[model samples]
Target: MRAFFWAAWLGLCSTPLLAAPPQGFSFAQKDWELACDNTGACRAAGYGVRRGEVSVLLTRNAGSEQHLTATVTFAQIEHDIPADSTASLLIDDRDFGALDALDESHFRLDSDQTTALLQALTNQRKIEFTLNGQHLPLSSAGSREVLGKMDAFQRRTGTADALLDKGDAGDDAILPATPAPEIIAAPVLHNAQPVPLSMLQRQKLLPILTPLLNQRCDDWQNQAIPAADRQITLTALDKTHSLAQALCWRAPYNDGYALWLVDNAQLSKPRLLTTEASSYADGAIVFLHKERGMADCITGETRVWDGKTFTPSLKYSTGMCREITPGGTWMLPTFVSQVIPRQQKEADNLALRTLYNAVLKAQKSDPELSLNKVAEQFPLTGHITDFTLTYADDTLITTSKPSPDISDDEWQAFLRSSISADSENGKVSFTLIDLDGDGKRDLIIDSYVGGTGLFSYTGVLKRGDDDFAAVNGSDSDNGDDFDAGVPGALFSINGRGANQWNHWVKINGQVYALWYNGQFGEDNLYLLRPFSTTSQTPAVTVRYRYTLNSIRSPEKDQPLTPSLSDGDKADLLRSLEVMQGSLLKDRPASDNDAPICPIPPGTSADEADNYYSGVAVNYIYETVAYIPVWLNGKCYIGTIFSHHGAYRHGVDAEITLSSPREDEEVIGDYLISGLRHVIAITSGWKTREGDNGMQ
Candidate 1:
């Protein structure tokens, strides 16, 4: 979940400080810091940054009936507090009562004490603790901002359970808690030995890994390692794969090692999992890092191998650095998962089957077969992780496999490609997978069905002797009640609405479809079973229904429009031309492939680089081209375009501009200002007047 959120954040926050608050984030103001993890739980910590003072930690779990908890620990910079010392809480110079000792220097506040402390923090009253005849005052410089962010993150600003803004609204609408996902670790091959890279192997593999190391590892690129220190070790993961480890960086307190998954036969490229890992053993990697030099607070992460890849199994952070306890005060986990051993998985599955059958019996339904057995019997193969689309003779083609010899841009524009199901001018996407029992791969194309409203039409094409062909016969004899058929099929699963969208997730070689109706609505999970032939359409069963209402819509603060001067507009046009030229330069040699940028009117072939050479005012008919953009595990096919300008029929690639400099670059400043308005309008809050481009 964190990985998905990170990718989305990268796409949205291309520029620093110009992005909105992400789904989950760590925000800090002054000495106070509020960290809202991926699971929606929030932890706010406050202490003096310059001096050792009293520190407090406030924690609130997601969902209703979850109350806020407060804990405090005395800051000991140079000396430790006496074990027998008594402590008392004071608010505005008024002593409430003796503090309950949680440890030698840490204290837990009672309900009444916590309430008074909250009031004091909100009212700017002094909060202090008297321990061993010493007064430790807690700073309140950034408490309000940090607390407000927490309330906003939990969607409790207007609810009765809100800590900052009390209102009449009920707390029932507050975001619900999401259970952490579970990962079962595969057994490690303890008998396998680590193989040091030989000189010949190093010479063969250094070119392939050097670029990745230079980008992801600090020690390899920034600091020169001695001949004795430089080393690479590979440990066998399975018959085909191995784990490669190398030193990443070194600090005063800890050293980080980079971990990568490499194919033993060098059949595929290496994949870097992390660069801050500590150790790897028993099919798991542990990461430990100190937050401060005092070693009072630390953060830890663990990733477990689940056969296919390294899965994030645990993530936690100890409370603020108060020196009350070594390795921090409390174990505050933002991400956690149950790890089951390989031997116990079968037993776990049996228990789960019994529970599922019990639920089905309660509903008067027949006991269904074990989903695990179904997954194993019909495991999906040739699952394409990603693909690029190009055109051949005005028809869209799917390029799932690319050659390593070609550059990224050139590989994106393929030479010979499989024709898509539709040629209509709309966003087209396809994936390659073994749909039938045949070992040959098949194609599943998603295209826009022609209509006044937006609709997605999915169809399957089976592999033939030479190329992919439509399903041979009608799927009406499949004995399923779904609105599915051969060749051109609607959504494959049952109970799916017209507004719903689907994305496939592969876990342990089995493919499952997560179908959702809206941005914040119920999700239908479906498992696609393999079929013997094209005529025998794969059966779909709804495995579970997940109600997703926790993710809320962001509040819009301004409109989407840029205030650009004539000079700024000219600079933007020039910048766009340069970007378009670069794309054309690296484009593969394909005359029929669709080009993102078209040749402008009256532009010669030799002068294609200057397509936007005319005066900026002349093209004041600047049209906003809407293209299909994939973000956050969903594809948004844009249909809205400005009516004021002529619509250009081609892909409008997203442009990333550099930071603005007063003396040199004005495109970044003006373009970003315009983007701010555009972002606000498209945020789904309210549309700007006379702007019909938002959906």
Candidate 2:
């Protein structure tokens, strides 16, 4: 049983001074720091920093319960983050659980997670927690000592209960080694008692049953039913359970007989349902095993019994699912319909068997099977890790598979032309988006031709008479190798590359791009706002232009060629011809298939250079500067000189603006490129209305 974690919000004092609290017992053990008051109340703390900052504390009052609380505080957040953001916790490879924010900087963990945390600390080698995609490790150096102290503190205060103590060695709260569903064994039926009830149960249900075993609980082990339990399963009331409220059945020796009377038993599957008390207790949870494994580790079902029938309430995981991993969780698959059908089971079937049947059915019916007509039927969702879209002719391309007709020589020849390792190729993973802004989902697929680690997408599947169809990519390309080489076409029998939209927005219906790394052709922070009068051209109001390192200040007209190849310089020049457009940010591609590659020791992605080079790494970011754009209007992007003009965008927000400058607006005729766009904005209770403007 998972523990329910309880949380409490601590009032954060300004500039939290993290030192030993002034109290009775205070000690610092490795990473664990603790301070206790005159009473036995103790407070322990530890913290971590990744993309953001957070502090974790485990506290136990003189007579209160133990719980872990985390305080989140960001020093500089400029991104637009929704107030309610959730963070996930992973102890070693197991996902212990998730943390929901109580407020902008306050989050609480359910007290229930304490068991998992303790297990991970004592058994697992690593613990990683992720918030907003940033990962950091949790220190467990002094966790054992700290936990021991907490347990000791409770004992000292006379509030500890051995039976209910979660951290105790005698408690059975941790995940049992012999989990019920997967076992397969048959009970022997040689010498068996018709009904076995101990003195305790006989006293409680004397009128309902007549027991054949007359020995004491400990000695009554001829079969396996404990002769000590007070409550009993009435045979007349339930029969589906193999036990049928009966005795212990054994072979010739009639040894190793133990009662299946424990509320939480140790029996494996075949006898699990029969061993369990047929009488309902809360609800029945069934485990679903994998597609072709002896282990039950895929999905599960929770059903509620209403006397005569069982109704499944929800589906859960029996164990860790590969498809729902650290990376897989981020890249979700798309399904044809949001509403999926659940496989119905026989009314008399056990929950465990019912769940297993559902798993097998899902494997065969899911759209991922990629069957010709099956895709149109019960079309399940496919991988849509990153939201990328492309349009090649009109096809919404996704996955590409090896053609059965292609020979080994042909495949080998094809592999030589690409840069990414053949194993690093992307499947036609797809997602639906409003491609035309009409609010209807359009399909997009991976158009990432191997090489140089740059991932892009190509659109396929044209909408037609009540269906989506692929646009033929092979028709236009002409090739000399009707059998050897092919054209660089995206949809053709040989090639494909579709025009794609990299995250950018058009201002006044005109493409406007931002420099990602720096401003003024230098790395720094700045803000740019765009607004204009109804009749005039849209203008920009650029402000907050500054550098963190004043020594390397940016100059408006400086050339921006840090390093470039002749071909790259040429490609950059041609892209500037119709200069009034967005500058493309060079994003390195991810080897989604790298997990399957047999990587060598000390090998990394940096070794790969071309479309087919260093194919071993997952992802590596390459630093790029802003492009010095030259436009047709000849409006040189230079110094800031506010001209007398009135626009309804800025200046009014700041009453500190000087005379003339208050009403003057810098004409934003020149669309700025090479500037990084803002991804998020920081907001909180303190800065609710941006009261701390420019702070």
Candidate 3:
């Protein structure tokens, strides 16, 4: 690519003059061209080029402390112009009313009393200027000279010293020195080795030469040459030639000797197309065809002679052939085996059906064994080329290309193995016996190896006493001697026989051992004993059930009376006082670590003031033991001292015990009514005492 450069002149102005009338300033062309402003605080200078587009602007502060400004006279190349351009500054935030533009190739911003000018010049691409009235020339030649001088100075003083000095000398102006030219070495090109034509070898040999024979034959029809020349050509075409000679000498073959092609251009050794046996067999009729001037095709007879008479048994045809044995004899039947229609057809159908059944059974049995068994039983024999099996209801049918015979054993083995349970831990086992005492035998199976353990299924058959016997048990250790300890046990119960039961022995233990029993309503387990103790009865444990009401009384008991002695009474009263003070009204408290009386603020002297009052009556009887009783339901138990006098007077004598008060009704409804009254009495006494100064 291309390289581009950009430069911008931003103007910032001090507060505009607002005093007396300001003097005007003008800029001469020479001053504009030579002067450069370094402060960067210069007023806006218009007449800068931007991609060959130009603009002029006048700036004035609009209002406010931020010094908002508006453009008064703005002129610039329209947006999207396809050239270098310059913008004329109209409104800058700091300047109140100013005009800025480029004049004489210099940036100039003019105001009433202040005129700022930037003496800068630019070529077609970029502008170059120096700060503080320092002029910088604007030519490639000037840049090269400056660079050369600077480079020479750097060589004289070293780069570090030159950079430190930077062509700056006090009281004297300094300019950058020019740089020296640089030289680059030319690139070298190497001669590459010629690439071998290996990729084109096959294409040139095979594709090109095969068609050349016919093309050359057609070329013979061209009669433009003289008759003598044609005869010479015909004579030359009748000679014996090798591929190498044909390409080198361009000669055709003779009818006597076999033609051999050779590719001498390739590094490989030359090859012969016709062996001596082939030459003898075909009587020298061999030809080598090569395309694109390379050897490819070799044509000769297959039979070879053993230095004697030529063999004539070689044959060539495009069809499939298979050798029956290692002696290289093709498998082709010379005689067909005769078949009786009825028997052969029946056997074929049976074989096909067996295969179909085997495949269908594989879906439910061990898939691998099912498939192999099918192949073993109904093997593809005779002239079968393809076969298919399908299902119809519970039966399986098969269609064969050319069906064959299947023996009875093969069919039976296929059915048996297909439905047989898979071996467990390399062993096949199952058990049957009555396990639930429901008369029907339960079947237990162990189909997989490594102790698939045992699984039991209840049988549908029933026996006497509604008992069900386990019909099968395998690899099970269910804690019963006859049923549990038996491994691969298959039992059958004879309801009519004298022995009544017969089971196959699978485990190594005694055959008469009772692994489990269905005699009881459920499975009865028995531990295995030695043969000597097999006749002894086994120990057993029984379980029972009960209900909750039989363990506790049903009715609630009456509360206990106050039975404290004089000393205990005093202690109790003091304790009650402390409890009342701490107990707050409407706020319940736990009896565990209950607050002492002398009730806190926001509390009451009623039952509501006592926290432990609402606890269960039985719980209170267990914890406190005191109860308040009423004689006539009014002012009797827990009565205030003033009410105590009325209780001592005629009211106590006349009141009957049968009457109940409204507050008594409320207290009776709660489970802890007795404790609630005691707490209320204590709290009431404290309230009265606090009022009487006894508190």
Candidate 4:
């Protein structure tokens, strides 16, 4: 395989950039495939069984007024066809008419011809073309299924604009064509600076790039390549930034270039963009891979420099190797973007990544490092003033200073407004975003409440009179569960991953937070009215519940089973025994420090075995477990938060009720003052347990 000139196959780039980008869907079956882009434009391509065969492309934009367009191209031939050469369109051996030549190998079908072709494909009739005294057959095998998906994705299946099952149904429900995401590209440098990297500069970058090189470029360790040849080529991206490129690896068809965005000053920090890049030119990292040895089909990608980092601009693929033209048949892109040229000054905004790196760097050595101290150590660029740091255990803003950005009255008001904290007991990180599209930014505080599950909470605080008010319905008198400071409005996700689960979208001019309710059997999409409230407090409604019928039969009432390691069981039972010895009819306040739910003495693991049962909230996956402990010769129900990794947190058994406290009420709040003592002592046990952690 060899590098093919993309400009030579310019005729194939006829796909138009349309206007509301969808999530984009693509499906393939047999010899046919369909692709719908973010703009809702759909393109279906079908071909013969093998490569170097004739193929057809069917395209239709998203809007209701859009019509289907058809084009056909012949297989590779030694002799070039004349520009005036035409191909006769045939449906089941019926010659509809001749198609005008698009170029040497491609032909364009008029609207009537396109309609006839669509009908033949949907009806499973034979489709062929007569060109140069030979018949070029097109398979209609998977055309119906692929085209049907296209119509369904665009919501045109029942509309007049649909290619399949066209009806008189109104086209009002059809998806509109959305514009491709626009990227602001910084001015491209014509040439690199004359000077090569000095020994000192190389030394600084060696540690930072060595790990990446070891992982991506196996050739770096091979003795065949000279040591001098394996160096990175650095080009000035801007005054403070540079682009670093090193050959990552070599493939049969192409060479991979590992690209990194480097900060000229901070050689310790570098971001890896891509390792499969081919070259960097015109402010974009270009990637091209030949699909086969013939170089007839290719896959290409372009990531444009967007001042801060490389942003994906285009992802292109030529439809199957009809071998019609050297660079494949037609342009079929999975992703597309509009690159708007901008001057360096115009694109020189402070990158959020820089701020994130600063924050992470400070916490690298000390995870407990406060964000306020981080800002003090490394002052961030932009017009930000003052800092408020909130910790995991902190109920209020622990440390805050007056801001120059707001007035004395406004600053005080802002300080008075606190985030609606969660009970998951995790540290919070705060950021600002215009969630409501009102131009005024809102505060988003994210926290990872550690347990078995890496459950997180994202609280929104919209700007109020002069401060921020919690969007978790703090002011509501609705007598909901949130009133007791319980965690509410949980981010609709489990585990620590991308912090974008709360997707805020605009519908009919109102911004609503859209999220998926991942219940056991109810996977639903819910829209939250961020500002809508009955009592001036925005509340998230809990519409889904985890009932007995959700996972088990309603008739059976099972006892909690003891699921604990021997060491954990001994420690917890001993703690409970200590509390049992201190129990009194009128328990003294000093006994609050005594551990509760400890197992009674002289009871064997079998005879005095603790029974445990676990339950998880269907939506958030937050789990709770209850265990029956023999305390003071009576069974006391003990409850604890349970999950996959809860054992690592040591034992935190809390007495939820006395023996008669059966049913599901044991999972709820119960009088357990002694449990407070268990919480105080569990930290020491967790620290000492090491590998034999408890729960």
Clashes of each: 6, 57, 100, 17
- Global fold similarity of model 1 (TM-score): 0.44
What digit string (tens of lDDT, one per residue) describes model 3 on residues 1-695?
00000001111111222222122111212111111111111111123222222222222211111111111111121322123223232222222232232221223333321221111111223332222222222222232222233223223223222312234332111221111111111111122221222444434443443343334333222355343322211011112312311121123332222223333354133333322221221122223222212211122223222122122222211101111111111111111111112322233334334433444454345321212233343221121112222333323343221224333432343333221232323332323343233333333333322222223211111122333222121211111111221222232222211111112221221122222222101112122211111111121111111110111111346332323345543443453333333322213533434422223355554642443222222210112221223223221222111111111111110111111222433222212111111011000000000000000
Residue 537 miss distance in model 2 (angstroms): 69
Report the lDDT of model 1 for residue 529.
24
lDDT of 2 by residue, 114-138 (tens): 4455566656367666667666666
Report the number of the highest-TM-score candidate: 4
Q: TM-score per candidate, in order? A: 0.44, 0.20, 0.10, 0.46
| lDDT, candidate 4, 151-231, per-residue tens | 899899888878787898987788866556667787766665423566876888778888879976877666676766566
Find the 10 residues in a row with the least total lDDT in model 4.
679-688
Cα deviation in Å at residue 100, candidate 4?
Answer: 1.6
Off by over 4 Å in 3: 1-268, 275-695
For lDDT, the strongest prediction is 4
Q: Could you tell me the lDDT of residue 391 within candidate 1?
A: 51
In the range 1-695, model 1's lDDT, one tens digit per residue, is: 11212111111111112122234566668777777755566778877433566777776756665567676776665778778778777988999888766446666677678788888888988888777767778788889999999899888988888999989887766766543344667766765766787776577667777777778777865435674454777787876778887888877778898888887777246788888888888688899898767777788888898888988876767656656455665455555554655644543344334333433443243222222332333333463533435555545454444435333432333222235443245455666665543565566666554433234556666666556554422221101112222233424322212223455534444343423231101112232222211111112222221111111112244321233445544544454434322332134535323323344467555555322221122121222232222223222222111212111221112222221112322121111211100000000111111111110
